[model samples]
Target: MSETPEKSAKASKSSQAAQPAATDKANSAAKPAKPAPKPKPEDKPFAAFINDDLLPALKQSLTERHQAPISLELVEGDRPVVGGNCWMVQGVLPSDRRFWLCFESDSITSGKTIALAETGSDPSLLESFLIDEKRINLALLQSRLLQRLNGQKWFGGN
Candidate 1:
Protein backbone atom coordinates (compact mmCIF):
# COMPACT_ATOMS: atom_id res chain seq x y z
CA MET A 1 0.00 0.00 0.00
CA SER A 2 1.34 3.46 -0.95
CA GLU A 3 1.16 6.09 1.81
CA THR A 4 0.52 9.86 1.26
CA PRO A 5 3.52 12.26 1.72
CA GLU A 6 1.90 13.96 4.80
CA LYS A 7 1.29 10.56 6.52
CA SER A 8 4.88 9.43 5.78
CA ALA A 9 6.25 12.73 7.18
CA LYS A 10 4.18 12.32 10.35
CA ALA A 11 5.52 8.76 10.86
CA SER A 12 9.14 9.96 10.43
CA LYS A 13 8.57 12.80 12.97
CA SER A 14 7.21 10.34 15.62
CA SER A 15 10.11 7.93 15.05
CA GLN A 16 12.62 10.77 15.49
CA ALA A 17 10.94 11.78 18.80
CA ALA A 18 11.08 8.18 20.07
CA GLN A 19 14.83 8.00 19.24
CA PRO A 20 15.58 11.00 21.56
CA ALA A 21 13.72 9.39 24.48
CA ALA A 22 15.64 6.15 23.94
CA THR A 23 18.92 8.12 23.71
CA ASP A 24 18.09 9.95 26.94
CA LYS A 25 17.52 6.65 28.75
CA ALA A 26 20.83 5.27 27.42
CA ASN A 27 22.72 8.37 28.47
CA SER A 28 21.34 8.15 32.00
CA ALA A 29 22.30 4.49 32.19
CA ALA A 30 25.85 5.18 30.99
CA LYS A 31 26.59 7.55 33.91
CA PRO A 32 28.51 6.12 36.88
CA ALA A 33 26.49 5.06 39.90
CA LYS A 34 26.93 6.84 43.25
CA PRO A 35 29.14 5.02 45.75
CA ALA A 36 27.64 3.73 49.00
CA PRO A 37 28.82 5.38 52.22
CA LYS A 38 31.01 3.48 54.71
CA PRO A 39 29.37 2.32 57.91
CA LYS A 40 30.61 3.61 61.31
CA PRO A 41 32.83 1.05 62.99
CA GLU A 42 31.75 -0.59 66.26
CA ASP A 43 34.14 -0.60 69.24
CA LYS A 44 36.41 -3.60 69.71
CA PRO A 45 36.88 -5.22 73.14
CA PHE A 46 40.40 -3.91 73.56
CA ALA A 47 39.39 -0.37 72.66
CA ALA A 48 36.55 -0.46 75.17
CA PHE A 49 38.91 -1.77 77.82
CA ILE A 50 41.41 1.01 77.15
CA ASN A 51 38.80 3.75 77.08
CA ASP A 52 36.32 2.64 79.73
CA ASP A 53 38.57 0.92 82.24
CA LEU A 54 42.38 1.19 82.07
CA LEU A 55 42.85 4.91 81.48
CA PRO A 56 40.53 5.91 84.33
CA ALA A 57 42.10 3.61 86.88
CA LEU A 58 45.64 4.54 85.87
CA LYS A 59 44.87 8.25 86.04
CA GLN A 60 43.23 7.96 89.47
CA SER A 61 45.97 5.76 90.86
CA LEU A 62 48.68 8.03 89.52
CA THR A 63 46.93 11.00 91.13
CA GLU A 64 46.51 9.37 94.53
CA ARG A 65 49.81 7.55 94.79
CA HIS A 66 52.42 9.55 92.88
CA GLN A 67 51.17 13.14 92.79
CA ALA A 68 53.06 13.34 89.52
CA PRO A 69 51.95 13.47 85.91
CA ILE A 70 52.10 10.14 84.13
CA SER A 71 51.46 9.55 80.46
CA LEU A 72 49.94 6.26 79.32
CA GLU A 73 49.55 5.54 75.67
CA LEU A 74 48.51 2.59 73.52
CA VAL A 75 51.43 2.65 71.14
CA GLU A 76 50.11 -0.30 69.15
CA GLY A 77 47.08 -2.27 67.96
CA ASP A 78 43.42 -2.08 68.99
CA ARG A 79 42.21 -4.56 66.41
CA PRO A 80 39.17 -6.77 67.10
CA VAL A 81 39.83 -10.11 68.78
CA VAL A 82 37.76 -13.01 70.12
CA GLY A 83 39.57 -13.67 73.41
CA GLY A 84 40.83 -10.12 73.89
CA ASN A 85 42.80 -7.28 72.35
CA CYS A 86 46.58 -7.05 72.48
CA TRP A 87 48.73 -3.89 72.48
CA MET A 88 51.98 -2.20 73.44
CA VAL A 89 51.90 0.34 76.19
CA GLN A 90 54.24 3.36 76.47
CA GLY A 91 54.35 5.11 79.81
CA VAL A 92 56.12 8.37 80.66
CA LEU A 93 56.47 9.54 84.22
CA PRO A 94 57.08 13.14 85.41
CA SER A 95 60.85 12.62 85.40
CA ASP A 96 60.48 12.08 81.60
CA ARG A 97 61.45 8.45 82.12
CA ARG A 98 59.94 6.15 79.47
CA PHE A 99 58.93 2.50 79.73
CA TRP A 100 57.38 0.11 77.22
CA LEU A 101 55.00 -2.71 78.15
CA CYS A 102 53.61 -5.45 75.94
CA PHE A 103 50.42 -7.34 76.86
CA GLU A 104 47.70 -9.66 75.59
CA SER A 105 44.45 -8.33 76.96
CA ASP A 106 41.97 -10.97 78.18
CA SER A 107 39.31 -8.40 79.07
CA ILE A 108 38.75 -5.00 80.64
CA THR A 109 39.33 -6.58 84.04
CA SER A 110 42.11 -9.04 83.23
CA GLY A 111 45.14 -9.50 80.95
CA LYS A 112 48.68 -10.83 80.83
CA THR A 113 51.85 -8.76 80.50
CA ILE A 114 55.56 -9.37 80.70
CA ALA A 115 56.35 -7.83 84.11
CA LEU A 116 60.00 -7.44 83.19
CA ALA A 117 62.03 -8.16 80.05
CA GLU A 118 65.59 -8.29 78.78
CA THR A 119 65.44 -4.88 77.08
CA GLY A 120 64.63 -1.62 78.88
CA SER A 121 66.05 1.23 81.06
CA ASP A 122 67.18 -1.14 83.81
CA PRO A 123 69.36 -3.74 82.10
CA SER A 124 70.04 -5.52 85.38
CA LEU A 125 66.35 -5.77 86.24
CA LEU A 126 65.48 -6.97 82.72
CA GLU A 127 68.19 -9.64 82.62
CA SER A 128 67.28 -10.82 86.13
CA PHE A 129 63.50 -10.92 85.45
CA LEU A 130 63.78 -12.13 81.82
CA ILE A 131 62.71 -15.73 82.37
CA ASP A 132 60.36 -14.75 85.23
CA GLU A 133 57.46 -13.80 82.95
CA LYS A 134 54.12 -13.84 84.78
CA ARG A 135 50.58 -12.56 84.17
CA ILE A 136 50.22 -9.95 86.89
CA ASN A 137 46.98 -7.96 87.25
CA LEU A 138 46.95 -4.74 85.17
CA ALA A 139 46.54 -2.47 88.18
CA LEU A 140 49.29 -4.25 90.03
CA LEU A 141 51.50 -4.07 86.98
CA GLN A 142 50.84 -0.37 86.52
CA SER A 143 51.51 0.50 90.14
CA ARG A 144 54.60 -1.67 90.32
CA LEU A 145 56.12 -0.27 87.14
CA LEU A 146 55.54 3.32 88.24
CA GLN A 147 57.07 2.60 91.62
CA ARG A 148 59.95 0.78 90.01
CA LEU A 149 60.71 3.62 87.66
CA ASN A 150 60.71 6.05 90.59
CA GLY A 151 62.96 3.74 92.52
CA GLN A 152 65.37 3.43 89.63
CA LYS A 153 65.47 7.18 89.31
CA TRP A 154 66.02 7.99 92.99
CA PHE A 155 66.64 5.00 95.25
CA GLY A 156 68.23 2.97 92.37
CA GLY A 157 66.67 -0.40 93.24
CA ASN A 158 64.26 -2.85 91.46
Candidate 2:
Protein backbone atom coordinates (compact mmCIF):
# COMPACT_ATOMS: atom_id res chain seq x y z
CA MET A 1 0.00 0.00 0.00
CA SER A 2 1.42 3.38 -1.11
CA GLU A 3 1.24 6.22 1.46
CA THR A 4 -0.01 9.77 0.70
CA PRO A 5 2.58 12.39 -0.33
CA GLU A 6 2.29 14.29 3.00
CA LYS A 7 2.80 11.06 5.05
CA SER A 8 5.74 9.98 2.89
CA ALA A 9 7.39 13.41 3.30
CA LYS A 10 6.90 13.21 7.10
CA ALA A 11 8.40 9.71 7.17
CA SER A 12 11.37 10.82 5.04
CA LYS A 13 12.07 13.74 7.44
CA SER A 14 11.97 11.44 10.46
CA SER A 15 14.36 8.93 8.79
CA GLN A 16 16.72 11.77 7.81
CA ALA A 17 16.72 13.04 11.39
CA ALA A 18 17.44 9.52 12.71
CA GLN A 19 20.30 9.02 10.16
CA PRO A 20 22.54 11.65 11.79
CA ALA A 21 22.07 10.10 15.27
CA ALA A 22 22.95 6.64 13.87
CA THR A 23 26.02 8.06 12.09
CA ASP A 24 27.10 9.83 15.26
CA LYS A 25 26.83 6.58 17.21
CA ALA A 26 28.82 4.69 14.57
CA ASN A 27 31.54 7.39 14.47
CA SER A 28 31.82 7.39 18.26
CA ALA A 29 32.28 3.62 18.23
CA ALA A 30 34.91 3.72 15.45
CA LYS A 31 37.20 6.36 17.10
CA PRO A 32 40.52 5.17 18.56
CA ALA A 33 41.25 5.48 22.29
CA LYS A 34 43.10 8.46 23.71
CA PRO A 35 46.89 8.28 23.92
CA ALA A 36 48.84 8.40 27.20
CA PRO A 37 50.92 11.46 28.12
CA LYS A 38 54.56 11.51 27.06
CA PRO A 39 57.34 11.29 29.63
CA LYS A 40 59.46 14.38 30.41
CA PRO A 41 62.91 14.71 28.85
CA GLU A 42 64.66 15.35 32.19
CA ASP A 43 63.52 11.90 33.42
CA LYS A 44 66.21 10.34 31.17
CA PRO A 45 69.89 10.08 32.10
CA PHE A 46 71.61 13.32 31.06
CA ALA A 47 75.30 14.03 30.63
CA ALA A 48 77.06 15.32 33.77
CA PHE A 49 80.32 17.32 33.63
CA ILE A 50 81.15 17.35 37.35
CA ASN A 51 82.65 13.85 37.40
CA ASP A 52 85.81 13.09 39.48
CA ASP A 53 88.31 13.69 36.69
CA LEU A 54 86.65 16.84 35.35
CA LEU A 55 86.09 18.48 38.75
CA PRO A 56 89.77 18.35 39.76
CA ALA A 57 90.90 19.50 36.34
CA LEU A 58 88.49 22.41 36.39
CA LYS A 59 89.46 23.36 39.96
CA GLN A 60 93.17 23.33 39.16
CA SER A 61 92.69 25.27 35.98
CA LEU A 62 90.56 27.95 37.60
CA THR A 63 92.81 28.43 40.65
CA GLU A 64 94.84 31.65 40.69
CA ARG A 65 98.02 32.81 42.43
CA HIS A 66 96.29 33.80 45.69
CA GLN A 67 92.87 32.34 45.13
CA ALA A 68 91.91 29.04 46.73
CA PRO A 69 90.53 26.09 44.77
CA ILE A 70 87.30 27.03 43.04
CA SER A 71 84.19 25.20 44.16
CA LEU A 72 82.24 23.30 41.50
CA GLU A 73 78.51 22.70 41.64
CA LEU A 74 76.48 20.61 39.21
CA VAL A 75 73.17 22.24 38.39
CA GLU A 76 70.73 19.50 37.49
CA GLY A 77 66.97 19.32 36.94
CA ASP A 78 64.88 22.48 36.63
CA ARG A 79 66.43 25.78 37.70
CA PRO A 80 65.38 28.98 35.96
CA VAL A 81 68.79 30.66 35.91
CA VAL A 82 70.77 27.47 35.43
CA GLY A 83 70.20 24.96 32.60
CA GLY A 84 70.27 21.18 32.91
CA ASN A 85 73.65 19.41 32.74
CA CYS A 86 75.46 22.63 33.51
CA TRP A 87 78.33 23.36 35.93
CA MET A 88 78.90 26.50 37.98
CA VAL A 89 82.44 27.40 39.07
CA GLN A 90 82.52 30.10 41.70
CA GLY A 91 85.63 31.60 43.26
CA VAL A 92 87.08 34.81 44.66
CA LEU A 93 90.11 36.22 42.91
CA PRO A 94 93.16 37.73 44.65
CA SER A 95 92.11 41.12 43.34
CA ASP A 96 88.62 40.59 44.89
CA ARG A 97 86.70 40.02 41.66
CA ARG A 98 84.02 37.42 42.43
CA PHE A 99 84.25 35.14 39.38
CA TRP A 100 81.46 32.84 38.36
CA LEU A 101 81.87 30.65 35.32
CA CYS A 102 78.86 28.78 34.04
CA PHE A 103 79.93 25.83 31.93
CA GLU A 104 76.93 24.78 29.88
CA SER A 105 78.11 21.61 28.18
CA ASP A 106 78.73 17.95 28.97
CA SER A 107 82.45 18.36 28.16
CA ILE A 108 84.93 21.19 28.30
CA THR A 109 84.41 23.13 25.10
CA SER A 110 87.02 25.78 25.92
CA GLY A 111 89.95 25.27 28.26
CA LYS A 112 91.22 28.85 28.41
CA THR A 113 90.50 31.66 30.86
CA ILE A 114 91.09 35.38 30.21
CA ALA A 115 91.12 38.17 32.76
CA LEU A 116 91.52 41.91 32.35
CA ALA A 117 94.02 43.78 34.49
CA GLU A 118 92.68 46.02 37.26
CA THR A 119 93.90 49.20 35.50
CA GLY A 120 91.33 48.83 32.69
CA SER A 121 94.05 49.32 30.10
CA ASP A 122 93.76 48.28 26.45
CA PRO A 123 93.02 44.53 26.31
CA SER A 124 94.18 44.14 22.69
CA LEU A 125 97.55 42.62 23.64
CA LEU A 126 95.88 40.46 26.26
CA GLU A 127 93.15 39.52 23.79
CA SER A 128 95.67 38.75 21.05
CA PHE A 129 97.60 36.52 23.44
CA LEU A 130 94.56 34.96 25.13
CA ILE A 131 91.78 34.65 22.57
CA ASP A 132 91.74 32.46 19.43
CA GLU A 133 88.46 32.39 17.52
CA LYS A 134 87.05 34.23 20.56
CA ARG A 135 88.07 31.24 22.73
CA ILE A 136 90.87 31.10 25.35
CA ASN A 137 93.81 28.72 24.93
CA LEU A 138 96.02 26.93 27.48
CA ALA A 139 99.22 28.53 26.25
CA LEU A 140 97.71 32.03 26.63
CA LEU A 141 96.60 31.26 30.19
CA GLN A 142 100.03 29.93 31.13
CA SER A 143 101.69 32.93 29.58
CA ARG A 144 99.38 35.30 31.43
CA LEU A 145 100.08 33.53 34.70
CA LEU A 146 103.80 33.76 34.10
CA GLN A 147 103.47 37.41 33.24
CA ARG A 148 101.53 37.98 36.47
CA LEU A 149 104.22 36.19 38.45
CA ASN A 150 106.91 38.44 37.02
CA GLY A 151 107.22 42.11 38.03
CA GLN A 152 106.18 43.24 34.51
CA LYS A 153 102.78 44.96 34.13
CA TRP A 154 100.32 44.10 31.37
CA PHE A 155 96.99 45.66 30.42
CA GLY A 156 94.70 45.87 33.48
CA GLY A 157 97.74 45.09 35.64
CA ASN A 158 97.94 46.66 39.10
Candidate 3:
Protein backbone atom coordinates (compact mmCIF):
# COMPACT_ATOMS: atom_id res chain seq x y z
CA MET A 1 0.00 0.00 0.00
CA SER A 2 2.08 2.94 -1.29
CA GLU A 3 0.90 6.49 -0.42
CA THR A 4 0.09 8.87 -3.30
CA PRO A 5 2.33 11.91 -3.85
CA GLU A 6 -0.77 14.16 -4.05
CA LYS A 7 -1.95 13.04 -0.59
CA SER A 8 1.57 13.51 0.82
CA ALA A 9 1.73 17.06 -0.61
CA LYS A 10 -1.69 17.91 0.82
CA ALA A 11 -0.71 16.60 4.30
CA SER A 12 2.55 18.60 4.17
CA LYS A 13 0.67 21.80 3.25
CA SER A 14 -1.85 21.34 6.07
CA SER A 15 0.93 20.67 8.62
CA GLN A 16 2.80 23.75 7.44
CA ALA A 17 -0.31 25.89 7.93
CA ALA A 18 -0.97 24.46 11.40
CA GLN A 19 2.67 25.01 12.42
CA PRO A 20 2.52 28.77 11.80
CA ALA A 21 -0.77 29.14 13.69
CA ALA A 22 0.62 27.24 16.67
CA THR A 23 3.78 29.37 16.63
CA ASP A 24 1.68 32.52 16.48
CA LYS A 25 -0.34 31.39 19.48
CA ALA A 26 2.80 30.54 21.46
CA ASN A 27 4.42 33.90 20.59
CA SER A 28 1.33 35.82 21.62
CA ALA A 29 1.15 33.95 24.92
CA ALA A 30 4.84 34.57 25.66
CA LYS A 31 4.62 38.36 25.40
CA PRO A 32 3.09 40.34 28.25
CA ALA A 33 0.44 42.96 27.47
CA LYS A 34 1.19 46.55 28.31
CA PRO A 35 -0.84 48.05 31.09
CA ALA A 36 -3.11 51.05 30.49
CA PRO A 37 -1.78 54.34 31.82
CA LYS A 38 -3.51 55.78 34.86
CA PRO A 39 -5.44 59.00 34.42
CA LYS A 40 -3.92 62.15 35.93
CA PRO A 41 -6.03 63.82 38.59
CA GLU A 42 -7.25 67.36 38.06
CA ASP A 43 -5.34 69.90 40.10
CA LYS A 44 -7.58 72.19 42.14
CA PRO A 45 -6.80 75.46 43.91
CA PHE A 46 -6.01 75.27 47.62
CA ALA A 47 -9.00 77.35 48.66
CA ALA A 48 -11.41 75.42 46.51
CA PHE A 49 -10.11 72.08 47.71
CA ILE A 50 -10.61 73.11 51.30
CA ASN A 51 -14.00 74.67 50.87
CA ASP A 52 -15.47 72.15 48.47
CA ASP A 53 -13.81 68.90 49.53
CA LEU A 54 -12.13 69.12 52.92
CA LEU A 55 -14.67 71.04 55.00
CA PRO A 56 -17.50 68.65 54.25
CA ALA A 57 -15.30 65.59 54.82
CA LEU A 58 -14.13 66.83 58.21
CA LYS A 59 -17.64 67.70 59.27
CA GLN A 60 -18.84 64.25 58.30
CA SER A 61 -16.01 62.58 60.17
CA LEU A 62 -16.71 64.56 63.33
CA THR A 63 -20.39 63.83 63.11
CA GLU A 64 -19.75 60.10 62.78
CA ARG A 65 -17.40 60.11 65.78
CA HIS A 66 -19.13 62.57 68.11
CA GLN A 67 -22.73 61.81 67.12
CA ALA A 68 -23.29 65.50 66.27
CA PRO A 69 -22.14 67.41 63.23
CA ILE A 70 -19.50 69.97 63.98
CA SER A 71 -19.84 73.40 62.41
CA LEU A 72 -17.01 74.24 60.01
CA GLU A 73 -16.39 77.55 58.24
CA LEU A 74 -13.56 79.04 56.23
CA VAL A 75 -12.10 82.23 57.63
CA GLU A 76 -9.44 84.57 56.29
CA GLY A 77 -7.62 86.59 58.87
CA ASP A 78 -4.26 87.09 60.53
CA ARG A 79 -2.56 83.89 61.55
CA PRO A 80 -2.99 83.37 65.27
CA VAL A 81 0.73 82.78 65.84
CA VAL A 82 2.54 84.55 62.95
CA GLY A 83 0.15 87.47 62.51
CA GLY A 84 -0.24 87.07 58.75
CA ASN A 85 -3.28 86.51 56.60
CA CYS A 86 -4.05 82.84 55.85
CA TRP A 87 -6.95 80.45 55.41
CA MET A 88 -8.48 78.88 58.47
CA VAL A 89 -11.26 76.39 58.99
CA GLN A 90 -12.93 76.91 62.35
CA GLY A 91 -14.87 74.01 63.84
CA VAL A 92 -17.19 74.24 66.82
CA LEU A 93 -18.17 71.03 68.56
CA PRO A 94 -21.58 70.48 70.01
CA SER A 95 -20.16 70.66 73.52
CA ASP A 96 -18.72 74.13 72.86
CA ARG A 97 -15.15 72.94 72.26
CA ARG A 98 -13.58 74.89 69.45
CA PHE A 99 -10.80 73.98 67.02
CA TRP A 100 -8.98 75.91 64.34
CA LEU A 101 -7.31 74.29 61.31
CA CYS A 102 -5.14 76.83 59.52
CA PHE A 103 -3.02 76.73 56.43
CA GLU A 104 0.30 78.50 56.23
CA SER A 105 -0.27 79.53 52.63
CA ASP A 106 -2.86 79.35 49.88
CA SER A 107 -0.88 76.79 47.94
CA ILE A 108 -1.40 73.07 48.45
CA THR A 109 2.33 72.77 49.16
CA SER A 110 2.04 74.80 52.37
CA GLY A 111 2.19 73.43 55.90
CA LYS A 112 -0.73 73.37 58.37
CA THR A 113 -1.40 74.63 61.87
CA ILE A 114 -4.12 73.27 64.15
CA ALA A 115 -5.34 74.38 67.54
CA LEU A 116 -7.96 73.08 69.92
CA ALA A 117 -9.38 75.39 72.56
CA GLU A 118 -12.28 75.86 74.90
CA THR A 119 -14.89 78.52 74.28
CA GLY A 120 -13.68 82.08 74.99
CA SER A 121 -10.12 80.92 75.65
CA ASP A 122 -6.82 80.57 73.83
CA PRO A 123 -5.99 77.24 72.25
CA SER A 124 -4.57 74.65 74.63
CA LEU A 125 -3.50 72.18 71.96
CA LEU A 126 -1.61 73.73 69.09
CA GLU A 127 0.25 71.60 66.57
CA SER A 128 1.83 71.96 63.19
CA PHE A 129 1.65 69.25 60.48
CA LEU A 130 3.60 68.71 57.30
CA ILE A 131 1.97 66.76 54.49
CA ASP A 132 3.05 65.62 51.06
CA GLU A 133 1.84 68.49 48.94
CA LYS A 134 1.86 66.65 45.65
CA ARG A 135 -0.47 63.93 46.91
CA ILE A 136 -2.79 65.96 49.07
CA ASN A 137 -6.43 64.91 48.84
CA LEU A 138 -9.67 64.74 50.81
CA ALA A 139 -8.86 61.42 52.45
CA LEU A 140 -5.42 62.50 53.58
CA LEU A 141 -6.72 65.77 55.04
CA GLN A 142 -9.55 64.02 56.88
CA SER A 143 -7.23 61.37 58.30
CA ARG A 144 -4.65 63.88 59.51
CA LEU A 145 -7.22 66.14 61.15
CA LEU A 146 -8.95 63.26 62.92
CA GLN A 147 -5.62 61.83 64.05
CA ARG A 148 -4.59 65.19 65.46
CA LEU A 149 -7.83 65.55 67.38
CA ASN A 150 -7.59 62.03 68.74
CA GLY A 151 -4.02 62.64 69.87
CA GLN A 152 -5.16 65.60 71.97
CA LYS A 153 -7.99 63.57 73.50
CA TRP A 154 -10.43 66.04 72.04
CA PHE A 155 -13.33 63.57 71.83
CA GLY A 156 -13.79 63.07 75.61
CA GLY A 157 -10.67 61.12 76.42
CA ASN A 158 -8.45 62.37 79.22
Question: Which candidate comes out best when scored by lDDT?
Answer: 3
The worst-scoring run of ten residues by lDDT in candidate 3 lies at 37-46
- Candidate 3 local lDDT, 33-114, one digit each (tens): 7787753222567777777777877887887887354578888886664567888888887767777788877765578888
Error of 3 at 50 (Å): 1.2
By TM-score, the best candidate is: 3
Prediction 3 TM-score vs. true: 0.64
Question: What is the per-residue lDDT of model 1 for residues 1-158, given as tens digits with 9 covering 90 to 100?
Answer: 89999999999999999999999999988999778875322223666656565666666766665534467776555422222345655555555555555455434333434323222343122111112435434465557655655555432343
Q: State each model's C-alpha RMSD to the native.
A: 13.1, 15.6, 5.6
CA displacement after TM-score superposition, residue 110 of candidate 1 (Å): 9.9
Off by over 4 Å in 3: 1-42, 67-70, 131-134
When summed lDDT is taken over every stretch of 10 residues in candidate 1, the lowest stretch is 122-131
For model 2, the local distance difference test gives 0.43
lDDT of 2 by residue, 1-158 (tens): 89999999999999999999999999999999779877533223333333443444444654544444424444433212322333433434344433233434433343323223233332222221233445333343334544643333322356
What is the descending lDDT order? 3, 1, 2
Worst 10 residues of 2 by lDDT: 122-131
